[model samples]
Each structure stands twice: as C-alpha cells, then as structure tokens.
Target: MTNELPVISLFAGAGGLDCAVERCAEPPLVHDGSGSPLRVRVATDYDGTALQTLARNFPHTKTILEDIRTVSTSDLLKVAGLSKGEPTLVVGGPPCTPFSKSGFWIEEKRNSQDPNASLLDEYVRVVSEAQPEAFVLENVQGLTYRTHQEQLRRLITGLRESGYSVEYKVLLAAEYGVPQLRRRVFVVGRRDGKPFHFPPITHSGESERDREYDPSKLPFVGVKEVFDGLPATPENGEIADGTFGELAAEVPPGQNYLWHTDRYGGRPVFKWRSRYWTFLLRLDPDRPSTTVQAQPGPWVGPFHWENVPNADGEMRARRLRVPELKRIMTFPDEFEFIGDRREVQRQIGNAVPVELGKVVIRALMEQMGYLDPLGDGARPEQVQETLLF
Candidate 1:
C-alpha cells in the first residue's frame, strides 16, 4: 500500500461512506484503528441536492452531478486526476430503498425489476474499470435476504470476476458506538484476493451482549449522551397535530405505542403488536434508540426525551430537531447540510454512521500493513487536500 490512499465515491449520497473512509485516514481514533489518512478525490451522484452537501463538506473532492449509469469509470478517474488503478479505495453506499424492509409493502419492489436494484451493478462496473486496490459497498440488511439472491449473487460474482476476494457482514451501528441501532450490510473486496478483516465490536449494552463481557466492554451509546448540551428548542417546537399528538406524551420515555396496548397498561386503544415499533416511540435516555428511517411518518418516533408544556400546561413529546438528528446520525456537530428541513432529514438518515465506517477502513488499512486498531495514539492531521474540483 502507498503512503496515501486516494478514494473515489460512487452513488455517494451525502458522502456517508466517503466520510467513513476519510475518518479511517485519521488513524488511532477512539476504536483504536490507525493508518495513513485517506484522501477523497472525487464524488459522483445524480441527486444534485445531496451532491451539494457533499461538496460543501468535502470541498477538495471533485463532485460530478449526474446519473452514474451514464458516467464511465474513466471519467470518474479523470475528474480525480488519477489514471486507471491509481486509486487506493473506492467506497459508496448505493441507494438501498428497493431493498429495504419497508419497500416490501409495495410488491413491485419485491422483485429485481425495480430500477434501483440495478445500481448495484454500477458499483461493480467502477470496480471493474477503475480497479482500485480495495472497495466497499454498503446497503440495507434486506439486500442479503434470500428473496434478493440474484442481486446479491450478481454483485459478488461481478467483483470476484474483477479479480478480488470478497467478504461482508451485516454490521450493527450501535455495536460500533453510534447512539442509534441502525444496521446495514458492508461488502469489502481486495484486489490481491486476500480476505479482509471486519473491525471488532467495541461497544455492548447490558441486554445485547453476554453478562460476562460487561466489565471490559463499553456500553452502547444512548441518545441522551449524543444530545447532551443541545437545547430542545428547534425551528418548530410545537408538536404537530396528528393521531398521536398529545397522546405521545402519555407514553413514558424508553417506550413506544406498545405502551398504549393492554399488556403495558396504557389506555389499550391499540391491539398488542398492532403497529410498527417506531409508532409514537420516545427516546430512552438510558439505552440506544431504534433504526432511524429515511422518511418517518408524522406519528413515528424516537422523539426527544424532553417534553414540552402544552396550552393546558400538560407536557407533550416533540420531534427531534435537525441538530439532534445530525448528532444521532454521527455526523460532526458543525457539519452543514444543503437542503430544506425534509431533505436534510433524508440526507442524515441515509448516511453511513461515520464512526462505524472508520472501524471498517481501519481493518482494511491494517491488512495493507498501516494500522494499529488497538492503539491509544492521537489522530494525525488529514492528508493533503485533493483540489480536484
């Protein structure tokens, strides 16, 4: 491996996977991974809004705003000022909507005909042409479901044919120290055909892991810790009027609509297990929150733990503010977004938790003989900025 790892991001929605690779560059971070910093040279995506956010956050990386299917890998490398096989890593999390658990409700999405399913091939196309030393592909856990065997198999076969060794796992974000319990599948490949090491689990909660491992392990991060000093005051502090409006307040912290069912002692307005778990869900300050969806319904939650007083002076639960959302998503506190409130939510929700990405890249760097994943050393300065844009 060279002293620097040049990275190219494809289908780079809000640069989440790129952010992870960059974090790995700053080795010896909290989870103990160390290595030479990664340089993000170019990012390509069709959504201009998301590209804008990625551009502003990573000003040095060249940004190409176009559908990937129309863009050739040669153009991607050229924009980054690199020739074929010059890049050290290519990282991206192709949009996973059609492969999501929620998409199953729309039966057309259950089949491979959905256009989004084909984007996985776009990722493989770049790996075949650009031929980076390594690559990482991320998507929803449902992509691994038996129903989607064709798509998964095609992805694996394409990479293997590209002269690489493939390894993957469904990673839990909370287990890597993120405040939310988001889960996704990460597939890694090395051109040399050597197996890759996924990072070790660095966090565990009392209930999630065995009791005996408790003493030496770090507990899973909770929402409270993530939002410690942020004020509950958001642009819209008033709770929106909806079916669960004032009623969300009735449910205590660390619970959801299940609290309203007969089994849990609320008003019993709902049957047992009647709705999605996120319905009327409130944050449990003491534990990790559930998966953060790209588009949550009006009554869906993991709402802020703090309650606000209504006109009658009674308290009511409120939605999470934008800043809180960014924190929970594991983006830096000062990170900026380029869209309106709703779009920003989608960007944050769709991002790969940055810290988790760092862990994975650390493992990749270690395989290349650059990391000390268990070291206590401090993070070094970022690599020289790639002024490709």
Candidate 2:
C-alpha cells in the first residue's frame, strides 16, 4: 500500500526541482489511497552552501556534498538504497553557465570554467549506470541556442543509446504561476520506449507563438495572477544587508532604490543616468518581471515593488525582499529558505518553478501509465478542455 516513489537528485542546488517533485509526489495526490507519504531519499550537490541549505530545508533526504561527476554509479545507488537498473526516477540539472546564453555571451576563458558545464556528460554517465525508469533534465534556456545545438543533439543521442525515449522543450516560469518571467529548457525521458509528451501550456503572453495557441482553452497567466493579493512589505528597517546596501530602504514609489543608494546617495534613478546600472529597471507591476539575473549587483535591482511613480517623477521602491523574491519564483510561503540574502536570491533565481515542474512530471507519469488523470478526479473531458486553453 506504499505509494512512495523513489527519486535520486544530482546537482541538487538548494533543492528547487526536488521541492517541486516532492510536492507533486506528496499525499492528497501521490498517495495510493494509503497514508504513507511519497519521499525523496537521496540528493547531491557540490556547493557547500547549497548543500547546507538543502540539508536545512529537506531534512528527510540524505544529502552529499560532492561533485556528481566523480560520484560512481554504485556510490549513488548505495545511497539510494537500491542497485543499478532498479526501477526509480532520476532528476537533475547540470550547472548551466557553459550552456547558457550569458555564458557564451562572451568569448573568454573565465566563462569556460563551468564546472557544471561538463555536467551533461556526468548526467549521461549516471543514466547509463542507474538505468532508472525515467529521468528529467533541467537547464538554462540558453542551452537551445545555436551555439549549443550540437551539444544538445549529442545529449539526445546519448539518452537514446541508454534506452530512453526523450523529448524536450523551452518552458517559461510565468506560464506556471511564477511571478517572474524566467524560461528554462527541460528534457524528459523514459526507459519504456514511450515518447515523452510536454505538459499543456496553461498561460500565454504578448509574444506570438510559432503556432497560435487557443486563448480560451489555454488562458494566459499574468503577473497579477500570481503575486496579486500578496501583502507588500513596508519600506523600513533592514532585515539583511548585502553589497547593494541595507536589505530595506525607503525611496519614492517607483524609483530605483538600488540606483539611488549604490555608492551615490540621493542620485537620480537609472533612467536619468546609465553608469554602473546594468540590471533591468524597476519590476513592472503591470507586467511580468523580466528575467531575474543570477547575480544582482549594485546599480542592479534588488528591484522595486509595483513600479509606482512619485510626484518628483522618480519611482518609489526598494530592493526585492527575500520573501517577495521567493514569491516571484513561486516558492510557497511555508517553504522556508535558509542563508544570507544574496545566497537566497541566487538559489531562488536558480531554482525550477515548482508549478511548472508539477505539470511536466504529471504529463510524464501519464505517458508511463503510472498515473491516471481520472484517478486524480480530473475527468478526460475536463483534461481536454484544460489542455485546449
């Protein structure tokens, strides 16, 4: 009567994708009408800070702070209480800088040290050894760029050779109720020879799709829809300080507090001057947030809230608080984040949006016949109707 599904995670940065997968696998759903909860027993990451954070949050899972590339297949399997070729699921994302647009944005040796950069090879190595029933790969949207086309093709070929039927697509975080407008590439593969199917899109945007998506059936998700009704934090006392300044400060309604306080107090917003201000301008409350950068330095936004303009023509706001940023990334209020403000921001920015992962995993499970929509109380007609929109 146990409904527990075994999962082994690699490159498990701050447990974002694992959190989503764990959430989707928990009771009220993943329960096989039994009370025993689904569980993720093993996770690994090379970063000490990330490992510590993962340990603090997911106390149930065993975490290893070691480079996944060096971890043998036997080492990983022993940690998971299983041997190679046992039926289980593997989920992970290689460190993405080498495969990212910003990474190739410049041609330099520094950008090439992408440790997780060789991570895809490690992923394939693990898949071949573990022989899991299914696997999921997460990465930056930049992976699909022209520069990485060949590397991607090779990864696909490797998975097929390992006996997996694979499919991939670029998924936007906003489409799954994350307030931020982040996009990532996902590769889902199964060992059963069934082609992986992408989850239906539940949100849309102004950008024209290659094929027109049904607006009525698959309604567009918006910024307001996700973060709306969430209470705003008042600009006041500092909660945590960072290189930018105090975690909290008071500025006009729509002005860039980061710009005003970045070693140049009382200065005009970024719109007025341009030096040292490379981050996106204040977050547009009316629209979804632009891509959240991995590192938000001085002159970069901790970002303003709501983008409200003041009488002086400067926008009033402060850097994004840790709570708000988590909300933007679609982390539930109860999902506690650990660490300093900067590290927290990095983790949140780097995580897979939980809602997006939920749909994708559900679709994959359906293709495997391991899950039935009707069993979950979702009627076939209703599923089709939801898909149309």
Candidate 3:
C-alpha cells in the first residue's frame, strides 16, 4: 500500500521544503512498485509574489494566498483534500525576521512582541488541529538563543500538549551538500511519540578537525564546483562599482573586505574589524558560499570569483546572478521565480536549501518505516544528489 502521507505546507516560500519532501515521497526502489509515500496537498503563504512562485513550481498543490492568522486550520485541511488528523506530514518555516540574528542578535526585543512572532504559534496551531503523523517547523537558528527561551519553552509545551514527541537541532546546510553555509533550526514532531532521527552529516570538511565525521563522507561542496557551467552576462558588466566595488576584484577569492585589514595581512586600507563581514565578500572556488542575504546592499556580496569585462573590456568582479544563487541554494535549474528581482532573491534567501531538507525528510521517512531501503543495501540517503539542472 502506498499509504500516502498528505503534506500541507505553510509559510511555503518558493517551495524549498516541498521540493525536498517531494523527493522523499518518491519510492526509492524501482521493483517495489509502490506509489509515492508522501503527497504535498496544499501550500499556503501570505506573500502573493511567493505564492505565485510556489504555485508554478508545485502546481500539484492547492495554493492559498492569505495570512496564516486569518486562515483557519479546518480550511487548510479542506484545501489539502484532507480531514482533520488524516494528514501524514506538515512542514513550514514561519517568517524568521523576528528571530533573525542581525542587529538584534542578542536583543531582548527578539521575542513574541513583534507581529511576526505570532506566526510561530500559527504553525503549531495548524499542526495541533491537523494532527498529522508528523510535522516539521523551520526557522532561524536564532530562535534557540537565550533571549527567546520563553518562546521556545512555550512552543515545545504547545506541541507536547498535543502528544508530540519533538526533536530539534540546528543544521548546517553545507554539511548536506548545499553549496552554501546556511544555518537553520528544524523542529520535528511525531504523534506516535517515537523518537525521530534527524539526518546525519553525510558531507564534511577536509580539515583535520573535521576528521571526527565519518571519513567516507564527501567534502562540503564548493561554490566553484556548483557553478561549473552556467550562463552569464559579463558584457552587461554588472560590476561592483561603488567606492569599495572597484576593490572587490582586488580582494582575492574567498576573502571579504577584511582582505585589506592589517590583522588579515593585507594593506590596512580599512581599520581592522571595521566593516560587516559581508561588506565585500567574494566566493572562494574551494569553499561553500556564505549565507546569501534576502536584501543585500549594492556592495554586500558573496560576489562572483571570475572577473568579467564590461563593454569597455575592463575586468571587474560582479555580484552573483540569479542562476548561480539558485544552484548554491539547491533549487533545480528549471525552477522559475515569479517575482521581480529583489522579491525573487528574498524568497531564495529565506528558503531551506532543497538538498538539506531532502536529507532530513528522507531520513525521517526511512527511520519511521514509511520508505523502504534499497535491495542493494544502500540507503536512499546514501545516494547524494548532484542537484544539477
């Protein structure tokens, strides 16, 4: 029996979790002859631009464009073609701006006061009402910070009241082969109260300190490798042309504005620790990209490594294009973004990397007996996806 799991997605920006969970739903073994074990039934979000993109990518899912606060749990189930308690899985990350680690990194104000903070409750509310076999909650790692401990306590208590045995951890996206260093927290719950096994790190750093990981693990994917072959328009020469823009090309790959800092062994063009870490960040071909920003300033970057010439033939470093960002974020090559440039980038920045979600969701399914192991003895998670377009 397929015994399909009906998946409902909330705060479903750009369908990153949906993409990964979709991969998990597909039966891994060919001869098993079972249909997909999980199905995404509905994806709901407040942003029309984001829902527009989600609908295009996941047309199989019913899209509801409404604020989660106003969207009733019964309505959500009905839209998913499900009755209460009939769903297999529900997944989403409420908007994380309230808990994001920006200037408010340690601010006590990063609490339930912000209007966005209420969205977390909305996630728990839906899961409580739907009573799925399991639910996954994604958010910025900052939620686990000491200042927000009260909220975290309430969240755990809220889910446990509904009989969920919850497990959570801060996961590194690069460790799962996404070509970027993104840190996020995932909270998973099982209605059966069985212990849930989070995905293991199948990829690791090559450094000696990283030897603690299983040696057979693959190296963390590099940005250059992920961008091996993609189209670009250096002729248009979207050069980093502000005051520091001209210096972007000179800073060398993988180094940021700190490249010119005295402490970093370069000429002290700027004071040590004077700028934000991302002020002039450039990609290192051999390293995974730093976390991309939702609203990067003109000079903020993990800028492209290959300096390209403008129409005048002057070679200069340029900001990353949409195509490269998608690869780094593990969005498939053909997936289309439905908004203007800034809005599109914001969706990508806010998403859980598709590969990272796939690793976690697949492991969860396998451990829970929803997925079968390969006859050849290799688990589905063992087979890494290139995620190439």
> Which predicted model would earn the best lDDT?
1
The runs of at least 3 residues in candidate 3 whose Cα sits more than 4 Å from the true structure, single-residue gaps closed, are 1-3, 25-36, 105-112, 206-214, 233-237, 265-267, 375-389
Tell me the TM-score of each prediction against the true structure: 0.90, 0.78, 0.88
Give lDDT tens digits, candidate 3, residues 1-389: 24446899999988888877776544321113232456789999888888888889878889999989999999999888799889889899988888887747445455446666777888889989999988888898888988777778888899999889999999988888778888889999899888788877768874312445456988888988888788754423357775775577787897888888777755679887887888888888898898988888888888888787655776678878888888998877878998767778898998888878877787777666666444222233432331111
> Which portions of model 1 show Cα errors greater than 4 Å?
1-3, 25-36, 206-215, 311-314, 372-389
The TM-score that candidate 1 achieves is: 0.90
- The lDDT of model 1 is 0.80
RMSD of each: 4.8, 6.8, 5.8
How many pairs in model 1 have backbone atoms within 3 A of each other, for residues 3 or more apart or on separate chains, i.e. clashes?
Answer: 4
Ranking by TM-score: 1, 3, 2
Global lDDT of each candidate: 0.80, 0.65, 0.78
> What global local distance difference test value does model 2 have?
0.65
Error of 2 at 124 (Å): 0.6
lDDT of 3 at 337: 93
What are the per-residue Cα lDDT tens digits for candidate 2 across 1-389? 25466788888988877776666533321223221123567899888888777787788788888988678988888987878777458898888778765545466413344545567888988998899989999998877877667678888999899999989999876665455567789998988777887866666654323345556554444445556566776533222233433322343332344446445455444344443333434655655666666666554653655443334554443556766666666566666766777777788777777666766776665555455554352233343444343
Residue 208, candidate 3: Cα error in Å is 15
Candidate 1 C-alpha lDDT tens digits along 1-389? 34556899988888877777766755422323343368789999998999999988888889999999999999999999999988889999888987898868787787756788989999999999999989988899999988888999999999999999999899988888888788889999998777998888888874333344354668888888878888756565446445677679888887888888889968788898889888888888877777777788888887877787766776778878888887777777767899877788888888888877877887787665544445432223221221111
